[model samples]
Target: MNSALGSRQAAAAVVLLFSYNGLVIGAYAASIPSLTARFGLAPWQLSTLFVCMGLAAIASMQVSGRLSDRIGARRVSLAMIPILVAAILTIGLAPSLPMLFVAGILLGLGNGGIDVAMNAIGVQVEQHRPKPIMSFFHGMWSVGNLAGASMLVLLAPLFAPDPQPAVATTTSVAAVLGVVAFVVAWRITPETAVVTHTDSSGTRTPIPASAYLLGLMAIGFGLGEGTANDWSGLHVTQIAGVDPTTGALGYTCVVGFMVVIRLLGDQLVARFGRRAVTVFGGACSGVGYLVTALGSGLPVLLVGWSLVGLGIGMIAPQVYAVAGHTAGGRGLAVVVTFGYATFLISPALIGSLVATLGIQKTMFVPALLLFGLVFAARIMPGREDDVAPSAEAEASWTEPA
Candidate 1:
């Protein structure tokens, strides 16, 4: 029971760190339009910069997740703080288009690496904790998103009179906050980490190919999230005829709703198993997109975006929960990282699809995927405790952590 308590504490710490990370990442996104206008880059050129960030993040996911097992998430996460702070600072100082792109790459790598380590350790910590904790833990990301976006939104006007002022102000404040969160969260991690092992009898396990299914699920959710993150604001402005500043409110609404939903998500999942939750959740997301694509007026856009938030709220966390149950030891981390990699890839892929089709139409791509994911939800293995030892034996086959 103490071990379980420790695990929950560990997971909570991971969530705090990521909440800070989310704040920093979200600030960067809000600042992008400013960055684009300041640099005078075309829309396609700006999109390419985001693609660079995605590719860098995807590349680092596996490396960081595997590194966590050997050195520990605490150490890797601690080391990442300085790099992240430095990246954010550099972003503020970026004076050229090329420099901004470079910042994106560095920021993406740091964000990805920290994400993998924290999630890997988080699930391991949740193993001993009572009830479904992963959803709440993952929900912290949304909390971070809310905090980060709120910070940007509040500061947006203050910086608004001038682009230079907005960029510098938002980035600097965000960097300081990020550093403080990292330091505090790092201090809370257990000194004697439980260290995950794959085999019940052995010390380590490798993530199986079957776990790619988890990544596939992630690709679906990632699309929804990516659409929200990248396109919600655009959708409001273009479709609902809102002012650019007011348009961002749509994303703000989504982020705020997601944060609340995720905070309460554990209770929801406990009441309804992951299978039912995921399928219905996907349907909710599909409806959200469909509404945004089809509906007119501010009220309709807000409603659609809000539904989008609710739908995706549990999807990513469930993937982590399933990975934790299916893969043991550091294998959990590896599988989570693989999912992050998909997260990295899907947005750009979706963006290209959007470019080819159009943003409003392109969203249907992820919506369709999530629509299909409703059916795929059945493939996710059942509860960790339900599997018999024979099942465990099959699950425990050869793999290095």
Candidate 2:
């Protein structure tokens, strides 16, 4: 569908869309403990759930990127909304383990598609802007994550102590937010992704070498982000020996830090350049895991996770912006697929590792992996990349009229 929205309005609509995606994920993040209890899930079982979700999400990415290019990204993104809602609801309310697997697959599939489609939309929107705004768009996603997790935390006191009610309420909130996001996207999303000549010409723009490096960087960021959103609360309960309610604060702190840095990320990129930011963020988060590993108390845990959040907040938005600016959908697809593979897979991998290594020790894995960001930083884009598109990218797309 064609969009009639002016620039600011279209930007707002995409922001809401990105936020809604994060909101759904946040609801899942908030309900992790409750879902664990509601299903009497063992660590391995949780691993299985994540594996199912990760695999399906990975599968969806393989197709969704090309699909978005074939059709309008707006339509593809809007189509995934209800699927996402149903998946999140099922996750919070599934009666059996098998059904939970179903929920995981559904959620993964829906999320994977929307993730690619929305980024496509975001990149297209950024194409028209004078300054880098991709990071701000992603920052709103962090805000949405904070909102989702905080909503559950706040509502828990009002409900009975049952985990199921919290799960239900969290999903209900997601459902409402999902509806609002769907309406906004349907009415005014800019659908700016190129869909005509490139599709027919059989043109497949080769992804730049740098985009691959960015994808490599994205993996560590994805793993770190997954850990914060999925298991920070549990990390508090297990390592810090806090009550589960207080553990909720762990999730909030990490994502909350993410919100601050992401909102400021574009400016930092403008000032320091993506390579400097990537290297610094990598070092900070790697050390954060070390700090987390050493700390047995709440302050240390929160501080460590806060560092992780801040560092990671700087990584993904820049990666997305660079890839989207230089590579278009296909390159972005390669990057997104690699990036989010770690995003969802980290949860499953950690669930498995946490069983053997324990949560405290498992922190080292991301720490080690994230140090790769420093190595990958060599390929990060300069300040010029923020404002310039690759000639290859210019050939592959025609901005929708």
- TM-score against native, each model: 0.82, 0.84
Question: Worst lDDT window (10 residues) for model 2?
Answer: 191-200
List, residue by residue over 132-246, the lDDT tens digit for candidate 2: 6777889998778768888888888878777688778889878877887787677778766564324336774455687688788788888888887778889988888879999
Off by over 4 Å in 1: 1-12, 95-99, 191-206, 236-250, 290-302, 328-363, 385-401
lDDT of 1 by residue, 126-238 (tens): 54456666677777776676666567678768766787776787789888887787667766764324344456675555566646777677777876787797789988998
Off by over 4 Å in 2: 1-6, 42-44, 92-98, 195-203, 227-252, 290-303, 344-365, 392-395
**Overall local distance difference test of candidate 2:** 0.79
